[model samples]
Target: MASSRCTQKYAVGSPASSKASPLPSFHRFLTKVIQMNQLHTPKASRNQETGRLSFMAPVSPPRSGEAARGGLSRRNARRVKQSAPAFISSPCTFPTVLALKKIAFTVTSAALLSTFVVSPASAVDKDASANRPKPPAGMSRVGGELLGRTGTQVKLGVGAPVLPKDLTGRSWIVADAENGEVLAAHNPHWRLPPASTLKMLFADTVMPGLQPKTQTYTVQEKDLADLGEGSSLVGVKEHLSYTVHDLWLGVFLRSGNDAVHVLSSMYGGIPKTVADMQAHAEELQALDTKVVSPDGYDAPDQVSSAYDLTLFARSGLQKADFREYCSTAEADFPGAKKKNGKRETFKIQNTNRLLTGADGVDPYKGIAGVKNGYTTHAGNTFTGVAERNGKVLLVTVMNPSSKEPHAVYKEAADLLDWGFAASGKVTPVGELVPPRSASTGTGTGKGPAAAREEDKGKNGPSHNTEAVAAEGDGGGGGGVGIALGIAGGVLALLAGGVFLVNRRWPLPDLVRRLPRR
Candidate 1:
């Protein structure tokens, strides 16, 4: 009986030990499953596009070492005693995928930063294009011609073609003084009489050389001879004398032919003055201009084109002294000395209808000094400048209708209105240089057969020459043809004009009028 009891006790103890041993095997199997799953779980490719991570069905409970398989039944029995929640509590094996997502986000963030940094460089280039100039077509050749022929050194680019066919007259040209771009053209190469408008060039060139004080000059018999009885005059008496400065004032303010001769002679004779004028014109390359007379009296060989005239006007306006002269609507020339040396003060007024507001034309709002010219050859020509809203414009109207100066002024206003409209309309024409007609009479000299004894002293000196012959004297415009010539635009005195409009902004309406090509 004692031996049997001992054997039973040993068997019970063995069962308890076996049951406890299963617990360690289950723990080891769980650890092995985690390691295997970690090894087998796929790592996403580095190049994968960004987004969310999707999970594959939970990987097959990884095949375990044999011990794990063997313990499952015992563990299941034990787990059945415990709660099911406690057994299922480990991480779902998704941490590795989470790590991969973080890495992708970091890479995506870096790529986004790089893209933002490089974008602005392209935008700056686009902004630069807006302010760049467009080349006007046919401009290069015109520029070359201006530089080569007239000494007007205008340089230009291709913007729009300026067709010559649309123009009228022997030659025609339109330019924007503010912008300096030639808008339309015809036979711009031809040279014709610039007439009295040439005086503007003389005034502009000589004003700087003047000493401005106490420079004395004498009036000669030649100065007073055969001055048209009815034509305008400063009443300079022969053998009388005046300061050189006053003579210039008279020449510019009154358009005095006598003062012109006196001044021209004082400036080293007409030839030297003419040469100087020509050289200056050459310097500017004003090719079509030939300055034979400082007064711009209707010399047959002296001629200028519409284009060259614009250049001349532009070049002259640059001088302050020149501006003072033409701008003077009224001035006092301390009287001419009589042959007996008596002094008398005389008032000289500018004949430019625009300056004096003599004609019906409305005065330009901000107009400064300029000259007016009319001759049988060059009818109703004007070179003018005006400023408004901090912008300056130089304009030239050559051979507009003599019957109406207002017509020309109105046309000029139209151009002015157009220029103010845009930023890019008129290109500057080189440098701004702001810068006359005649007739004969019916009366004969008061001397000869019935020479009136009282008239001899009152009517001034008498000459016996035929009145027509006297009327046709020096620097005077050819007569009889003006009225007839005006009727036919084909004649030398055609009623056409040229205008130059320039500004900082493109001229408004300028583009609308440009040639289609």
Candidate 2:
């Protein structure tokens, strides 16, 4: 015999584009069940070949004319879209199989979801959480005890596959900049070499100190000594003069260590610059950061943590010039002269893959900047910020576990995707504590927005270009999580997905599927 009713097929769409998309479909199935009057009976039947119910529905009696007249209203009918009963008036009449089915479904889904949640929120049952991988002793990934106390911690989803895919970073944090909340993190306090990710802190400390961008400095031959072997350079030449403004560009866009040395020497010396940076870190309450070199080349006893790196980014983003330099995809870099009184110039590309979108990476929509770093010791580390719908998020990943160079950026993108999707939907797991308090003294820090009109006019477009393309968007949905409620039980599922697409060209598919960071 052939059954007459069954739920249609479900083809999952991209999670990011659809909002509460799955709920309606799942609900439709339940509506059929609750509305049953039991006057009509289910005819047990099977597909001729498959040997299964063609439509395994429990046929119910049609709504009585008197009952329909007694209850449904035009307004209520409109609200339900005529798809389901307005209320479950006969709970006792519901078949026992419904209960059995609901329980079985919940159990099956929970078992499947458990395989994915390796680092669930602390509130989850201990038996379910027992197998979770905790960081080794002395390692501090996602502070378990702190989460319960701070109440600022968040899990991306109940069971969303939104965890940074292919993440190899041993320590990382995703934070909401506007709320100053840590959405998700692991080993936040673990010490590691920061490589160039520390540059944001250096910039936050030094950019203001070099007040006169117009002031020119002739590079000293001795400044070249600061360049470490096997390190990145911005092609600075001894005896060539570079304005404080242009050198800052080199420091940001190219991750130029040589430019950092020149700036460090101008401030005082490497030793003084390092001391100032450390002092600034203390003021910011970035206790995990110890600055031995202003340029962040590997050195004995020099270290920083994911938490401190995010603090540095949060503080630095307040200055508009810092935003401008970091987001610039490409800009003209003036090179040394050949004695003809004319300077050569070439485009210096930002090494930050999140901004440039080259190197098999997708340019993060709304991505501005913070910094990225790599060294033999530090591996690849990145601290990044992105904005959407007025909510800005920061992601800092230190020392990717993958050997690939782009893994850090890719993992950083994944974390950012998860952060944006998790915003508002999940409660924070930890708080990004603000600086204890700043007592007013003669303040050296002047954010770019506060700079005089005359200064900005004099500096001009040749020095800085408009941001590539950051635009406004609407806020994301709230109360969303990986674990969805199926009736009274939990159905663990991915709540959001990778949303970015290359609007410009043929390689859009290549970008979406790119395995690199």
Candidate 3:
């Protein structure tokens, strides 16, 4: 019944001829039917009715701003309204059948074209990060675990697996001159005599700045006067002259105390030189270490921990020239000619047993030129770099007893073996609490009472609430807080996207308000 009424309301009719002009009223009714059909017929039949209207008379101009109100403000609405036959149709009474078919095809083609148009270009970033190489085995083991534990909420991955309990003794640490993250430490805070290993720091202060070939120093009366010295010495006579480079070879290779004093005095007066050594130590942030003598001699105040000694040795080895000097097993300082001066020649030997194959350390097998030091106070200290299968490991041992220097080596080997077994992998937890802005607060884990005392004492930076829980607090508020923050950030972003979609297109009301014509 509704369809019948629609057809009557939007009538379709044949055109009246001039021969029928005698019935002008009938002709008028026929004309009105054609106009109604042109205005209100279904879109599929409108083209034919449009042709009849065009043949009968000219088209009227559309109302100003009517098109804007009808649809163009919205993309989908504009598509529906623009394609309506009244908007673009040309009237032709004969061949209306063909026009209707053409209009149907045009509408179908427009919809399909919209679906198949090329999609917008998406942003694509090349992942150059994957090309980076893995860190060394020792790094994989130590820094991996520590960084993983601290930054796990970021979800990087778990750190290369390591037995943390196995990492307890033997004095371990993870330090980088770059980041300064001492990821793991054992007995790092303790101070002990550094023994001969202290020479590495002595070499660090001297080697880089020396014009080795040009600078020459004469052995002072006091420097060479002490004969039959129990400590390491490069025997030289009083008033004997040597180049700075030659003295460096002796101090580095033979662990020569005799040559160390000569270099120290030549670089600056003894007092100023010793101050520089202390200053260098401060620069490296090796606080527990104090150097009373340039050589790693047994002075009452000269002390360093295993960690600090490693830090000192690391600084020296980082220099290409320093490593060349220390790595040399033997060197011959040229003898003075009789015409030039009295002939004085000496063969300096490397003291590091690991390189010499002494005390069961075999460099051929693995160990590299690192210094060894021993004193009554410091039993035996060793630091060296070992390379195997493209993996380099740095090991430092402090005060292993005379009977147990090899045992320290064995333990280092074990760490290397275990470290390589775990590939370079680490998981970083996101910030437990967002890193407090330095502008707002210091992240010191101190309480208010402690902070007040620090402020009053004028010792250093004050303690603050930002201090995180102590290391090894397996389950703490910091850990829980970090996990929750990451989850919250992800959820919030998802909700925002959904809200934007709903705001852009509210469709249900538009469909319900479509008016019946």
Candidate 4:
């Protein structure tokens, strides 16, 4: 009955035809049917505003075949009103962008995200938030368990060194840098303060933009003024200009927040530097990191996981300048000149105990360079890389037991030993999950873009992808990455639902009023 009424001639019989899209007009016709069933259709109730009829207001229901009182028609206007699409007046035009309805849910989701703020996108109101996916019993996403868990045993073969209990740090990862495979790990994705070790990520992002020995910046009082309290300084004096190389040395050897700010000011600002670092982190698939500060001071929400720290080191090591500065145990720090116009000089020692052989810690065999960190909240964090017999290994130790400050390096040393020995045997128990790629579909577990990026590095040899998690391993398999994948899928679906609502109920303020089962 409704189909016949809708198809029957309307404009052909009485009303003047128009050029407005038929879809919008049909929407109004449906609205009148719904309104007629709910309220009394009043007589000739034309809306003074909009110069159109107000079909929503009290209106008298059609009597048998009588014309519903309104303008723009001669006979009962029933045929045109009911068939062509009943309207208080002309139909409102819907934007062409709404054509996204025919696209894939993923495509629609991307569009809706731009159109709706949280208020407009309030598909999940507080009342129905319970329907949202909840973590397993007794589990919470604050641990990032929805995405993945950090602490898990991994082994490549029957006798591989996938030990986590032996490591004292709260999080650690030992990966074969030559092959882009995680040999072993413990809570590698557990978010923890990185202290200065995050400088690796800073350098990785900003170093590309800087011209090392050529890009010089004068140190200003404002540059050194905002150093985090009790944070390390590279002895950068006010009014002294330093080259990019020198400031990086300050970052690598002294873990200088002062040097970071000076360089950050050179690059942009701390905020922009942090944003770039975060963007680079996303690019590197360092999912377990959030950069709130360039120097990795114990700022709220500033965090990095062992897995992410390893990724930072791996990426940073690609540049010759980064490797050189990190490997340099001692360097000349240019100081503020005397009134007599003589330049003063001071030596800044590398804080990495293993690399510099400092504080009774024996240097790990074949140790090259990376970074280390310490703070009240972070305790101690260290990222290290070593090459022996042409095999390069990377290890990251974060927030070691506070009782022993040197334990962080000690933990890294132990992992380095195991990584080299177990390199041939272990598979990645937990993977370094890549960031979302545009080309990857919702179902694909990984993206080719990520694979291509990791396979190539800045001025470095291509990392071997053979020993990756793709092959079978004897390590304790980790399903955390899979869990996070599932959670991510749920979010995509929720976003798709938003666009569907926009398409189905194009009218304002009508979504909430629809009946529910």
Candidate 5:
């Protein structure tokens, strides 16, 4: 057998070319065998077959005068020669069995690594999905199973007025503000665009941190940026200063995106405001709501249910300021200051037709302020609370099918009328459950009536009847149990997968095993 000499070179930084340590004895021996086989093989044959060692082999430099025939330049060829490893000598014979064995080992190692490495990432994703609370299905049975049902749900006693025949809202709810009982509902848990009605939640979240009369912010150009095209505006002007009271008036009265943006900017920015609003919604147990824009502009995935909107109204009414702002039919908003330094003012009226009787809509008797919203997509959505005699009722209507203008207000008013007439004549379909913290004894979960009773005991009667009627028990849903159940199942599956993988591969380094009995 004639002996042949060959030299292998690797890229400067590749693992094969690394000078950190000499190759293991088995790898060195395999390298020598593969190089000898390559030296004897024809150039075309070598190109056609990709042996395991081909990646480690350097191209052979051309013989004398070959460089002049369109090969590497003299300087580059010299560098390649200098970088080449020491020459090896061996007989030319292909080690077919050994090469096949190495290739099989390489493929097996890759598969094992991928199984262990990628599985944990996939498991993490599954765990995250399992941990997030789902709406309607996974949410707490706040008002029992009746509120969670799909269609109309109500319990009418003998002679109780039938639900308004013309009610067409996709989702509607009627509940007693006194005892937290749901009087009637239709698709209460159906999530739909809430439009400006979501502003009620926004107000409940940001209002506490601000002092309407004391805290004032000068509007900046940046405050008005990204307000969504054709959004409702209260004509908020940049470079002008307005008290928080004026901004809120603009919000409740005009359903103004400009005022919303300015208020959100005062808190932090839109991102922070959105995050806070989301947190507040979760706390309120408004599980069906997903807040994408603080202003409630039509955006992807932003939705709320009639059940949740009613909860927002009930929570908001607990505060006196919220009651005052929502009920005010009209207010003067601050405008540009004149040259003489007196600030100009303009009148803005509430868009809630049931409150102001605007747009040919009749004002509901004893109607207190809540919120109303409309968008091309949302159509019309409203949540209102009203009092009759000494009893208070809350009603929410969303997305009526009728094309007539002011249909939402008409439907809500009808529902309110039915709720008052049905009082004491019908059993509640479900009761609004108090907030998780309240029911769990961690916070005050009392609705308006309970709070009023407490106040009467201490202060001897609440003379403010409007405040008393607007107030309602603050309650929300809880989904921790559902989330935990899903998480536990996922973890069980993960453990079983690990056990099977360990039985086959035996990762002693990662998972220690007990001794067999």
Candidate 6:
């Protein structure tokens, strides 16, 4: 038979004539071979004169030799059994080579596409790692390892109720106040603004030094000078003398920044009060807190975590005065002196809605007291201590996203309910670790014992009703730190792989083409 003619033209002496023309011929031959193999065309389909194959005709039964061999004829079987080198070099073998090339192209494209798809995820991971908050210097995780984790942490037993799904707080923790067993938590270590809740630490630290009934502070213009705009105040008048008891009432009942400032001044000054609060926090092992303002006013870097706030609540409640002040729903604040040389007083109610049950909010049963706080930056934060059936639970909720009035109190109430129900039914996720001095033998001169003694001297014997429990010294160690490092390393590797893939196949145009939200 005459060989088929090549009708296609290529430029003379061009690279296409030497290389490109053969590719098309090879491709066409492979395509036809593939069609023939798939269709299994009958022998009648081949033209006897040209010896050319056609695949559109009907298939035929295998010949006797092909049937014996299961598929191929004897001649074709011999060709298949030939050595690899000869088969590869033969023109009839181009189909196998083309098939392999197609597979290689497909695999390579798929791998490239996979890298492209994964690069954005890697970049996002790297960015998250870069932006993740670092723990305070030399500050260990006071709570257990589970508290260090980012999402919800819980260990339910056979009959424990699930945590409330409607909880929208950025960070929260429910724990036993007496035993310091953390029942459950969500983002417990996330450090955010604490608003006025930091006052628990402030009051815990400085309240011991000043005798509430014996000491009196005369409010000065400078005492209230640094008050933040729109600060809650208990109506402290300049040049009026207020007993330390009255100032604390203002702090707890009204969340009064003016009262906080005057007390801070009496505690030395705002700077000294802040420093003392920081030192007290470290002693309590509230490692996630950074106290910039004594009144928990929104200041730069003034942050605390749910875990730390719970620590504050637990520690503050151990003191008789702190407990009495926080639990007090309403109290009389000294007002301007009456004309008859008598000082009248105005009523100030506790800002903690769960305690006061004012403003249409139902009072949480068994509610004792801790504190609630709010600021534009901190949103709403609360830490409540409640007792039920001899089981006291401490719940701290921070930055709940709901805009409803008193949402923080509602969430705290819900968590408290869940905690009470789950008590003894769920295994503790972590422990509210003891103060630094409590673990170590060293005396910080500001330990719980010293605070207790100070409380005894100031508040007398009968007021010291609750005893501070001894906490175990178990440390969370370097587990969380190591996990963070590993995460960063994994993100780094992903970022590097993405960089290499982008170097080989640039994706700037493709990335730019992505539709904006």
Among these predictions, the greatest TM-score belongs to: 6
| Ranking according to lDDT, highest score first | 6, 5, 2, 4, 1, 3
Predictions ranked by TM-score, top down? 6, 5, 2, 4, 3, 1
Give the per-residue lDDT digits (tens) of candidate 2, residues 444-465. 2221222111222221121010
Quote the positional error of residue 206 for candidate 4 in Å. 0.9
TM-score of 1: 0.48
Candidate 4, residues 90-144, lDDT tens digits: the string is 4434422232221222232323332222232132222123332221222111112
* Residue-level error in angstroms, candidate 3, position 374: 0.7
Candidates' C-alpha lDDT: 0.45, 0.57, 0.44, 0.56, 0.61, 0.61
lDDT of 5 by residue, 69-153 (tens): 1111223221111222233234213343433343344333333333333342343233333442332332223454445544566
Higher-lDDT candidate of 1 and 2: 2
The list of candidate 6 runs beyond 4 A from truth reads: 1-140, 440-517
- Per-prediction TM-score, please? 0.48, 0.57, 0.49, 0.57, 0.59, 0.60
Total backbone collisions, model 1:
58
lDDT of 3 at 171: 47
What TM-score would you give candidate 5 relative to the actual structure?
0.59
Displacement of residue 193 (Cα, Å) in model 6 is 0.3
Candidate 1: misplaced stretches above 4 Å?
1-179, 183-190, 223-232, 336-342, 401-406, 426-517
What's every prediction's RMSD, in angstroms?
Answer: 37.0, 24.2, 34.5, 26.2, 27.9, 27.0
Per-residue accuracy of model 3 over 228-260 as CA lDDT, tens digit each: 235666654467788888888777666667777
The segments of candidate 5 whose C-alpha lies over 4 angstroms from its true place after superposition are 1-141, 440-517
Q: In model 4, how large is the Cα lDDT of residue 439?
A: 21
What would the per-residue lDDT of candidate 1 be over residues 440-507, giving only the tens digit for each residue? 12212111112112212221222222111121121111111111110111221124422222223222
Cα lDDT of model 6 by residue, 1-517, tens digit = 0011221232212223224434345446545543444344222111111100121111112123221111222232211121233334434323554444433433433333333333423432333334434332121234554455455667677678878766767788888765567777777767889878888999988987887555887888989888877677778999999999998988887888888999888889989998989998987767678899898877889898888888787666655677678878767779999899889987767777777666677877777788887766676788987767757778999876553566788889999999999888776667766565343212111223332221212211111101121122322321111010011112211322221101011122222322222
Q: What does the lDDT come to for candidate 1?
A: 0.45
